[model samples]
Target: MDNPVGMDNKPIARTNFGSNFKIIPTNDQIKELQTVIRDRSTSRSDFVFNADRLIRLVVEEGLNSLPYGDMDIITPTGETYNGLKFLKGNCGVSIVRSGEAMEQGLRDCCRSIRIGKILIQSDEDTHEARVLYAKFPEDIADRKVLLMYPIMSTGNTVIKAIKVLKDHHVKESNIILLNLFCTPSAVSMVTKAFPLMIVHTTEVHPVAPNHFGQKYFGTD
Candidate 1:
């Protein structure tokens, strides 16, 4: 019955994105979000609503990590001061269906944001993420890509997403891996493969073994 007001309190960490990945929420809040999403007894409606709320918080927190510039401002008292403005070199792209589920959250927090869509699905046998669809703006290379995936299990989907983004000429530092739930192995796999890529996840669960000994999760 809690209002989900503290989802943005989850802790964050530094990966490959330099100072560009700074939204760090807390571990406690991350766990809370995961618990709500994973609870079998929760109604589908509640699940979707709560998950959306959490995703909004995540998006807002992520926005805070973006690079900013200083602007001159005059106060009501006639004093001059420097104010921070959001750096405008980034774009957001969500993995279809589940990833798109977070799109409204991103829109609510950003002004004049451009959203791209990619479809990646998990192979039932291999548990790998295969890209079924992708479409991006021609100017994507000039903007940071907020690659969104709702869950990070084996990291295959996100990896493929990154590959797509890179093929379009987007720099590694310009790609941020954003997810709702992630496993330690998933984070490690992506970071080890792409050191310059930064990741922002709500929570990291311990490893869960797949049929082929690979850590995996069920994605609908």
Candidate 2:
């Protein structure tokens, strides 16, 4: 896939993050993303519906980043077919309310995949993120993890979440961050902090608007 071009007219690959990041490359995916962004100006229901569609695209892209193994399957016609299967041990970890929005998309893509939750909130004054609660599959350390968070603006929350995963013995390389939108600052911070981690997103905005979640949830 070709590198995503940022609003500044530069390739996303020039951000110094190396190959640890991927942006949805298809025109159809980009078109859907634009539709979701536009729906933000309409009713909440419209925004949610479109947002879910975009999330599904990103989740599917994230799943593609996971390791897969080859297998032989018997088709209905009794013919041998070679197929690829996701590694056995895998799970999804949502970063909380906003992240939970992507759970359905994850489930739709990976049937019966285990899900974990981590609640983190940023301090109003300090802007630092703190984990309020976290739950993960007991075998998460051995499973490839998809860390779900719709927006990565400051990256502090993602950093904290990764720390929590590390505390649980989940290797950095095994974690894939699935996001819908992000800023260059956020990408820089995340990739610098965790070079081995992979970040998959539908778009990278030059600047992350403060009202994204509020607008989507109709609280703005």
Candidate 3:
């Protein structure tokens, strides 16, 4: 199949990040919003609010990477207007707990989209990601999947989740990972392993606010 069509604006691919690793272009507004969430002194309410704003942006960018088909529709003026339809079905799979935080943003765009869950935890000793629970749509194999895992640090958890998707017959090329914050090292690691998969993130930094789940959920 042809590679998933990236955004018309195109995803920025820095030479160091390699191809298929798309960074959402950021501006002053995004920078300030990110700063609010990243600041340790920020209140939980502000953190969650600003975080959702960034997540929404990342979600929109991820949708742009999916394939679409052109269709002309008659407008109110009785004129044919060109429109586009998604090429195939899409379902979301969120890494349990943390990834669930992004579900609302995805739902905002896809009101009735199906979403699945995978629970993975890192072993304290080896620090390797282990999948404990997973539940997916019966027809996940036929749908384009948006894997929602906000913060990608070591990339171990994402790689583990991708393995599960592959076992379920989801094509590597058909999956789009909707992420908000990621470290450059983590991006490099994930891309090296799954070159065909698409990853859309707002920014790539050396360090990520891994406590995002706790802050967003008021657990911190």
Candidate 4:
């Protein structure tokens, strides 16, 4: 981890940790994915296939951090072994449109995972977003939530989403922001705003012109 200067002229570690924000990707993995995605010659289909695989890997990585307790188990060779169990069930919520692309991977990785939806649109004038629709199970407060939104170039939408979850009593630590792409500025924004929420992004670009930049491989 490295330190960046802040308004107070003090050193700040470059990671976000709080009740709701956590970043999941390492610099190496993110760079590899970015190289593949940025290749103009890459076929759209192939690009998507690889992206989906990468997303699955990220989901699995995040799951490994959840609370787990060891239990005695017998191996196939009749040897004693230890295993872990999920402390609680989890929920997956997508930020609509592009987020839908990630649902399949999350579903495939988690058994009978509950899916939630949040629809947010940006205002043409203020550049702020309004949540047009949202529906999450009443039990979401108790479950670990996986929030998905692709290409987080700007932190506005995701920040609003976190606020909504908090208002509903969901702890920031229980929320994980899953995505395929993000910018350094956006990462800094979310990490600074909601340090506890883990962010699992496949790639980090320098800074995108808009929330959805031209090079971003997303469904606008």
Could you say which candidate leads in lDDT? Answer: 3
Q: How would you encode candidate 2's per-residue C-alpha lDDT over 1-220 as one tens digit per residue?
A: 6565577757766467668887778587577665566553567777777788888889988988889999999999999999998779999999987888889999998889999999999998887999999999998999999999998888999999999999999999999999988888888889999999999987666766455577666777
Over 4 Å off, model 4: 1-32, 208-220
The lDDT, on a scale of 0 to 1, for candidate 1 is 0.69
Residue pairs in collision within model 1: 9-25, 9-26, 10-25, 10-26, 11-25, 11-26, 12-24
lDDT of 1 at 202: 57
Candidate 4 C-alpha error for residue 170, in Å: 0.4
Segments of candidate 1 deviating more than 4 angstroms: 1-30, 76-78, 207-220
lDDT of 4 by residue, 56-169 (tens): 877776676567777889998999987887777688898876777778888887768888999889877786978888899898889888888777867788988888888888
Whole-model Cα lDDT per candidate? 0.69, 0.85, 0.86, 0.71
RMSD, one per candidate, in order: 6.9, 2.1, 5.7, 4.7
Looking at model 3, residue 149 earns an lDDT score of 97
Candidates' TM-scores?
Answer: 0.78, 0.90, 0.91, 0.79
- Candidate 3 regions with alpha-carbon error over 4 angstroms: 1-16
Which whole-number lDDT from 0 to 100 does residue 136 have in model 4?
A: 94
Winner by TM-score between candidate 2 and candidate 1: 2
Q: Which stretches of candidate 2 lie above 4 Å from their native place?
A: 1-13, 26-29, 38-40
When 1 and 3 are scored with lDDT, the better candidate is 3
